[model samples]
Target: MKIAVVGAGLGGLSFGACAARDGHEVILIDKNDEPGGVMALAREGGFSFEQGPLILTDLREDEAVGGFLASLGIHLETVRDDRGLSTPDFDLIPPEEYEGPDWRKRRLEELFPAEKKGIREYYRFYDALMEIRFLSGEKKGLLNQLRLLRAFLTVKPYENMTCRRFTEKLFSDEKLRLVFNGILADFCADADEVQCFTLPFVNTETAFDKRIPTEKKGKLYYPSYRYIVGGCQKLPEALCAYILEHNGRFLSRTVAEKVLVEAGRAVGVRLEDGREIRADMVVGCGSARDFFTELVGEEYLDGNYRRILRDFRPMEAVFMLHLGVDFDPSAFQKQSLCYYYGSYDLHGAVEKLRSGVYHRGSDGYLIYFPDRHAPAFAPPGCHCVTIYTVCPDRLREGDWESRKELFADELIRLAEEHLPGLSEHIVAKKIVTAEDYRRLTHMKKSSFGGAVPIWKQRNPPYLTPVKDLIFVGAQSESGGGVPIVLLGAVEAYEKAIRANRAEGKGPAAGPV
Candidate 1:
């Protein structure tokens, strides 16, 4: 079976490599000069930028990602033992910010000492939930769900209630509520809009049970987190190597013009170079909208089906700024680990963004100094940083292209405020704007990958209206981040096998 996968992002690489390993002919095509697509490595002078995916949370002991990497002879070490803290020694930074698994509970103890017992029980419940899900192989039977129904309803509460409403019930202080709010902000939705299940998503990220460690005044504090030994690019490069070693082929620097579909079935893909590559399955690691409306053509889809994919909203876009500095970046690592501008009005800031505004004063950003843990990122005595946050996908002041440099400059200024002299230390830099994201990652309007994690789009199914056409990547609405994207890739691979079985085709006789 010849499988043609479009886009060489993490999702595509995972599926293609898995299929090729199973003795299927896999041909991955991407417009980029190398593999890995968006997850691909970017370097300048002697500095390397992680590009996409700031953290690779391990999930569980049986995490498919670790297994997949092991199969490719890639061993990842636990990197960055770190915690979040208020940075830059500023007067505005809340003097008592916290990080790590213990921070949440410890924070409540400090601000609302009376709620200490309730806080302990709250985290205990969530810890058990993670255990149960892990035991169920991340899937629960009907009986299991029914048995857990009461527990689910406990945290879940009313379906539409946001994190603000839910957490306020537990803590009255707005700062404490905001402290907890940081845990779920990845959803890109307002605190009030974020759903309940996010607790497990945030806590169960580790492969092993993390025994909370004591935090000292100045050290990184988390017990579990995996950073690439050398750089994040190692992941995609390893996947590509595995696929190639299994005899899989790749068409690099080629744009996929369309997916060749006939009689309501996908046959192959037509490249922009006028070359058509035939395949038994077409798994697109790009936007779902692109496959139906652009690649396969909207005429191939029914009007109603087309409308649903069209109406599905893209996740909010984020601004990513990577800076390579001439000075030792680790000097600011303590501040960057999870530094946040304090006393923020998260809900109000998010609201302003929806109205096409930049609430610079109200909104806070994340700064991660990779070199502190992974020195391979920059040459000796130098460092690299990833500064990002959710920003409006569509801007108000000017087009993103025209305004990108200014936005980056402002971000640098902000970084300077947080890590005094961050501006002077800079030697090289790359700014990823909404427009750059749309072009590089093929995201819809440069939206971040993954659904908002509400009922509708959270963990959306793989099967599509078009038979044998499975969608992977952010637009499918499965939760975002590295682990979730890889999980979707697993679904895609399994579905491809089943699709072939249904057609009376078994696994390929040998590797392609």
Candidate 2:
């Protein structure tokens, strides 16, 4: 079968790589000069920085993502990493001495003695959920099913509570509540909008401190977080190389103008240059709104798919400032990355973001030391840093390009609170706004991540109404995150193959 995948992001690349490996002709199209989409490296002066995921989970050799890459002959060196959480009055940074997995629980209990009872209760629920997650990942078996059933019964009482109610029910102190619900603002979602079960996954202790063991009693108790030794761009680069080695083609700097449909089946794609490449299957990724309305024409979509496209909310863009400094930021920030939240009002912050208000990094921002994992990202005696926050893709007051510098300066000033004398460092700086991501992702709205992950929210599905046209990526039913997208792409390809076989269609010749 010949496959034409639009948007050379991880999703498309993964799908194309799998198809090419199976002896199918693959064609990947993207507007960027290179693959990787958001995973592309941003270079300024002599410094390089990652514009996408900071730390990824489930890429270890035994994990789903790693095993998939290994099948494609792609092996990337990875290093363990963690993030720190801080507020104006307190911080949840890892201690210099290695603490156990229950460290965060103990610390929270200490800070809010009045709510110690509630904190302990929450951890019990957290541990139960973790057990369920661990078991669900295990191979199918009667024992696993029995264990999962028992685990699910333990926390069944609080399953329906929203994040807002869960936090308020657990902690009376506003500061304590933010500890769990603060991360929701990053998703551009209100605490009341997400489920209580989401609390543990987002606040995984292993993600906050690399020292926390991922295994207990010879079983994987918690998920491990890792960074590709060189950079995230390595993942896409390897996939592209694998695709090319298998006789696949990439049309970089090309725009897919439309998905050609014939007899209710997608037959090919037409490039903006008026060149049409016929394919047995067409895969669409990136910006569901753009893919359906601009490329696939809404008339071909079913009512449910169209309703999802209209109702589903994609996350807003991020404001990233990459810097190359003469001094070491690691000195002040012990960890390579730290999430400094400015406010405890997560509900208010998310509302402001969706309403086209730019917080200028005041609500929350993270400081990441890129040179820690990838030493090549900086010059000798120098280090690279990225300070960023999730903000509105389209601002209400003025455009992103016009306010880019002001927002950059504001973020720097806010970061100075964590790294003293940060402004005095002579450095190279690159400001990335929503407008830049808009052009990069080829979306007018420029949602940095996929969807907001709202509870019961409808997202674009992989199997579309149009036969032979499959969708893969963050916006798809798989949702966002590196591991999800990679595995989702493979699953989507399998689904497409199954659908083709069911329709009695055999593999076809390569596209001309």
Candidate 3:
């Protein structure tokens, strides 16, 4: 069957590659000159920077992304990170900082010396809750939910509450509350908004069950994360090469204007240039909103799908400040990723962000000193640093264009607060606003992917409403992250192929 994958991002490229290998003629199209959507990379002044998705998590052990890449003859080096929480004053720290079974206990002791016992019990309870879910997978039905309930009753019934409420119950000190609630910031959500069922998985999954090695000072995992040799662009480039090698064609700088629907099934896409390419299936590697509302047209969508697109808010857009600095690596602290939260009010921060406002001091900030992790990112004496914060795509009740510089200055100011003289070391800098992201990738509001990864919305079962027109990417069930997008592409193509074959269709009838 001939398949047309619109938007040659990781998801689209992955689908094209797999479909071509599965004996389908595939055409992967993107408006950009290259693939890789958000995984795109930029280089300047002897420094290379990833445009998006800096960290790679190895979720499932067996089909780990590293193994998948190896299967494709793409080798990647891994860097283990040892990261933890530090107080606003940078004095009080987590127990993971010290080491021992009592590390969490000790850390809690330092934060809430009065409520040390409660903290320890809380950790144990959270761990147990995570173990049950990991062991039981996502409960599917009333029976499975009953099983989960039974397990919770037997182990930790307190898991039923929200993390914010639970933390309040566990500790009285606001600082301790901040430390505990700060963990939710990693998910770009607040403790009250984030599901408690996800806390354990996130905690263990992100921390990788390893203490921050005193030598490394960040979280460590068995399979380390290595930047793609040249940059993240290499991944998409390699995947595109693989697809072409397998007889798949890619159409770059081409936009799919609309999904060509007939007889209640999508048969092809009409390009903005007025060219029509027919296909047995169309897989959209774009945002849910764009795919449903724009390409397919809201008139064709059902209420539930439209509501999901309408009511379902996207994750926050990020304000990224990429800097090329002239500095010695040894001159600065050796930290890969450093998160700073000005206040413990994470929920309030998220609420403000949802409404397209920046939270005061609560702006989610991440400082990436790539030279500390991968020297290849910069020259011998220079360093590359990126300061990122979650912000709404559009400002509330004002023109974001007019306020873009102010936003950028605010980020720089925050960076200055953290790294003194950081501005002086900057040789080059670029700011990526939500508008820039939207213009570049066609993502709605330049939103980051996978804001919500609940159990019900987890994988292939989360298909779009349109018949031949399928959806992938962070907005789809697979959720964001490189590995998930890759997996989503493969799964979507597989489904398309099976459906096409069942219909006895051949290469889709259309102009090449």
Identify the runs in model 2 with alpha carbons over 4 angstroms from their true place.
139-146, 477-479, 507-512
lDDT of each candidate versus the true structure:
0.67, 0.89, 0.67
TM-score of each: 0.85, 0.97, 0.84
Candidate 3 lDDT over 141-259, as tens digits, reads 78767767666764456646677777777788767767656756544666766545655545542352234331223322223334443456777888888888877888989999998
- Candidate 1 residue lDDT tens string, 332-408: 54443564654456676666667677544236777877666567778877888878777778888777778777878
Whose TM-score is higher: candidate 2's or candidate 3's?
A: 2
> For model 1, how big is the CA root-mean-square deviation?
5.1
Segments of candidate 1 deviating more than 4 angstroms: 59-62, 78-80, 85-104, 114-121, 137-162, 203-223, 302-307, 458-460, 506-512
Candidate topping TM-score: 2
- Model 3: residues with Cα > 4 Å off, grouped in runs: 59-63, 90-105, 129-156, 186-188, 205-230, 360-362, 453-462, 498-512
